[model samples]
Target: MYTLKKSLGQHFLTDESICRRIVASLEAYPSRQLLEVGPGGGALTKYLLELRDIDFKAVEVDDDKVQYLKKTYPAIESRLIHQSFLDMAPPFEGPFTVVGNFPYNISTEIVFRIIEWRAQVQSTVGMFQKEVAQRLAATHGNKVYGVTSVLTQTYFDVEYLFDVPQGAFNPPPKVMSGVLRMTPRAAPLDVASERKLFVLVKTAFNQRRKTLRNAVKSLFSEEELQDDLFNRRAEQLSVAEFATLTFRMR
Candidate 1:
C-alpha cells in the first residue's frame, strides 16, 4: 500500500458503495471512452475496467500510487497514465466521460481543465468537498453560486447526485464530500465568446458582494452599467444572463 501524501491531497476512497455510486453516475452518460482522474489506489478503477465496450484510461500523478495500482491490478498497466490530469492532453480520440474522487486541493482547477475540454468531454462524475460540489451545481440566488457555478452551467447541465460522508475514506477528511455529474447541455447558453464570458464571470465574482456595476466596471462602459441588471450582485445572475452580458462587454 502507498502512503497518503498530504501535499497531494490523497484521501483515497475506501468505501465500495460510494465507489459503485460514482461509477453508476458516469455510466448514465454512455461513452465508448472514459478517463478517471487521480485514481489514487484503484478504488474506482477496478470497477471502471470491468465495464464492457469501454476504452478506459486513468491519469495518476502520484508515482507510488501508480505502481501500487499496477502491481495490485495488472489489467490497468497499459491504461494507466503517469501524469497530472491538468497537464495531460485529452486521453481519448473522441468524446469521453471523466470520473474521479478528485484531490481536494486542486479540485476546482480540475473542473476548469475539464471545462476547457468540454467539447470532447461528453460527461463527468466526480467527488469533491461538499461545499465545492454545491458551488458547481449552484444556481442564481443560491449563496454558494459564483464563478464556478455560472461558468460550468454555461455549457453543461450540472447535477448534485448525492453526498458521501467523511468516514467513507481510509483517512477521513475533516469535511463531508459530495458527488456531482455533468452532462453536455442540449442547447448551451449563447455568448459572444467563451473568453469574454469567462472574463466577465470571474471579474464579476472578484467582489461578489458588490453589484455588477461596481464589480465589473473594467469590462463594460459606464453607460452599459446603467442597465437594471447591473444593480444585482454577481450571485444573483443566472448562467444565461452572464453569457448574454458578455456581448455587451467593452
Candidate 2:
C-alpha cells in the first residue's frame, strides 16, 4: 500500500524465495538476539517473526512501512524500533546477528556502524549494491579493493554469499545487488593501534594511484619509508600488511 520512495532508496523485496534464503543465512549462526535493518514491505520480517528461539527486532526508518509492519505482523509490536539503524543505540544488551535488504543509499554507512559495534555483533547478513559487496569481499590486488575491504576485513571475515537480480524487488534497482555474510574474528587483529591502522588505511587510499610511500608520506619519515612495503600502491597491500605498516608509522 505504501509508495516506494526513491529518495529513501526503498526498493522493497517482493521475491519470496530470496527472502527465505537470506533469513536462512542469518540463522546459520546461533544467535540469541537478532536485528533486521530496513525491513521494508515485511518481506524478510515476516519469516524472522516466525522464529521462536531468538529475540528478534527490526529497525525501520519509514513511518508507513513501520505502521504497516506493526499492523500486518502483530508479532513485531514490541520488536520494532522506530529509528534509523544509524541513529539507534545498540538494540540488545549483548551479542546479536543483523540481517536485512539494507537501503542502498545508506548501505555503506550501515557497514561502518556494524564495524563500530563489531564486539557485540556476532555476524551480519545483508544485501548491498554489487560493487560495494565486491569491495567488501575483495582482497588486495582486486580493482574494487579499497577502504571497505581493509576496514571490514580487520574485524570480520568477509564472505560473498550470492547475488540478486534487479527483478527480485517491486521497484527493482538499476544496479544488481549482492549479499554478504560477515562473522567476527575470534580474536581481534593484532595491530599496534587500531586507530593508527585506520588512519593509515584511509590515508594510503586517499591517493590510491600513488605508491604507499608517496600516498602516506605525511604520516611517515624518510627513514621509515625505506621499507619495501612502501613501494606498493594502496590496493596492493593486504589487511595484515596494512597493520604492519601501522606499527612502522613514525
- Clashing residue pairs, backbone N/CA/C < 3 A, model 2: none
Which pairs of residues clash in candidate 1, taking residues 3 or more apart in a chain or in different chains?
A: none
- lDDT of predicted model 1: 0.92
Off by over 4 Å in 2: none
Candidate 2 has an lDDT of 0.90
The residue-by-residue lDDT of candidate 1 on 1-250, one tens digit each, is 7999999998989999999888887757889999999999889999998999999999999989999999999999999999999999998888999999999999999999999999899999999999999999998999889888988899899999999999999799999999999988888788999899989988999999899889999999999989999999998888988988989999
Q: RMSD of each candidate?
A: 1.1, 1.2
The deviation in Å at residue 103 for candidate 2 is 0.3
Give the TM-score of each candidate: 0.96, 0.97
Q: Locate the minimum summed-lDDT window of 10 residues in model 2.
A: 185-194
TM-score of 1: 0.96
- lDDT per model vs. reference: 0.92, 0.90
Residue 105, model 1: lDDT of: 97
